[model samples]
Target: MGYYAKELEALLRAGRFRRPIMADPEKLDMASNDYLGLAYKRKLLRRAFERVAAYPWHAPKSSLFLGGYHPIHRDFEEALKEANGFAAATLFGSGFLANLGLIEALVRRGDTLFIDESYHASGMVATKLVRGEVVLFAHNDPRDLLEKLADHPTKGRRILAVEGVYSMEGDRLKREFFEIAEWFDMVMVVDEAHSNGVLGPNLLGVFDHYGITPAPRHIKMGTLGKAYGSYGAYVMGSEETIAFLNNRAKSQIYATAPSLLDVALAHEGFDYVAKKRKKLRKKIAKLQKCGVSCGYPEPEGLIVPVPMPGIEEAVACREALAREGFEVGAIRPPTVARPMLRVILRTPLEARHYRELFAHISEWRDGV
Candidate 1:
């Protein structure tokens, strides 16, 4: 216990420990995943309040199999399934739970899981729990994946897992990579947590964004929080796949089901996203332009990575911007391979904010 305390003190002194922050209304937030600003939108808040005022104000007391499942849960799943073109969908307490349960249940001791090295922490941890051969391929590299698959002499089921939009890098999986997975007869699991409500014509996620249809063996996992401005997660697949999860997935089977309030909020959030899609696209376009103007990579989506080179530089950049009444995330080791400043775009920003941000960056860079 004394050694643990000493290690924690060292981490805190080294600026590695994370701390929670209160929402500052005056500061411009460039760090959050509220891409469309729907999380703080007046409409969604009013809707949530209305739902809470109605019924089930308390937490669902049990897991889905016991007494937690409700009509709203089914309705939410059905709507997501239809929207994403999946035959069935099942809800989870969170994106972490969905990834954990789905991957752990599907892969067995004899199976092989070819996971992208840059997959989310949840999926990474889940792969470790699976009693199988887990091979991590280079991030978004089809050639690397193909070579790895060729080298492995496994006659068991091969599973390929990737993210539709990688959270830290803000890059997406290429179509060629998907083609490689198909050629190898691997079960494809795409986590679209970051792209679900922010991409595609109908906001169905990466499949729709790339104009590709999900195959029968493909499983899609996504969250309701980021772009939907709600909570919980869901997995979309064929009816048989979902049925298997209902009985086999320990995460969903043992955890308390998402409450009525969450279901109502998510349903309302989906509708809100549908209505605001056009305006949100315009915001992304504007943000992309801002990134270019600020001498950063042309942002292809809501997430933008501003290079700061080293850990010290990245921390300095975050602090510099914060001093100017702007709050942006500082990315460091573990979360990413290298240090960089992470910026997330939202809907309410204007051209002047971008110009000012760039000015601050220039000043900070020159030590003004």
Candidate 2:
């Protein structure tokens, strides 16, 4: 207790210890990534239960890529393509591996990589592996990328990586940046982890909302864990790119594949959200009506990261919220230093629920 006391005390003092609130089916939920309430949907659960029950005793004997490939796995990939209308896609056990594997597989020795300054932590780690020149551009500013690419030599494959919709900011990528990647003849790779089932009317993802389809060199990565209400991720790209990743990506080649049950559960979730996203939009509007300002802005996406000026204040705020039964966490350095507090919005976050949460928030004087 003594050894852990300092960390725990600090978090409590600052208001950052996120109480793992047990989901009270009876209580109105305002905090979660289940944007469309797909996880709780009876239809998806029935499918998931059936699949899991089918394999009651044990998992499949072999890896899906080798001799272990199952019909369900192929079906999941097909469902993903059908949902997003991409040329091809391949699933990963999780988003971390998908982002890390894709970047390391594409960017090589002589290439240059330009990434958004506020990109995900996985991207930052992926940069360390590639023996290429890594340059940081101001977040979401195409102008910086334009200047950097113009100044840079027409070297080996240049790739511009960014989040399709920023996780913390809850903001969508500006359309102007697409032309920047095209002008430089760079590969445009975007991580759509946070937007898979929360952005568009049906959560068809970023492209669906913006109507910007990917060209040959463009690629999009998404996760089923966050808003999709399941586990695993996928990278959507050209057929050649998908093949290259399948054959060349070490993470894919060496790692064990996702469980059959996991894939089935994920597919059920995707299908559930596809049918329910439009109705969920009204719930999102109700959340904003409660005076809980989105960190970025409204009607953009589901994330609502509040930029707390200071770490202590951000930490304190999370603590205060949790004490009142709101399980919000204070996002700080390493996660999102720019925005100290990230407000993640999902469906079922009603106006009255936020009012109750805010009422508790108003009681706090200052954060730790």
lDDT score for candidate 2 against the true structure:
0.73
- Which candidate leads the pack in TM-score? 1
TM-score, every prediction? 0.94, 0.86
Score residue 48 of candidate 2 by CA lDDT. 75
What are the root-mean-square deviations of the candidates from the true structure over C-alphas?
1.9, 3.7
Off by over 4 Å in 2: 1-31, 52-60, 292-299, 362-368
Distance (Å) between predicted and true CA of 310, model 1? Answer: 2.4
In model 1, which runs have C-alpha deviations exceeding 4 angstroms?
1-3, 49-58
- Candidate 1, after superposition: displacement of residue 237 in Å? 0.8
Highest lDDT, which number? 1
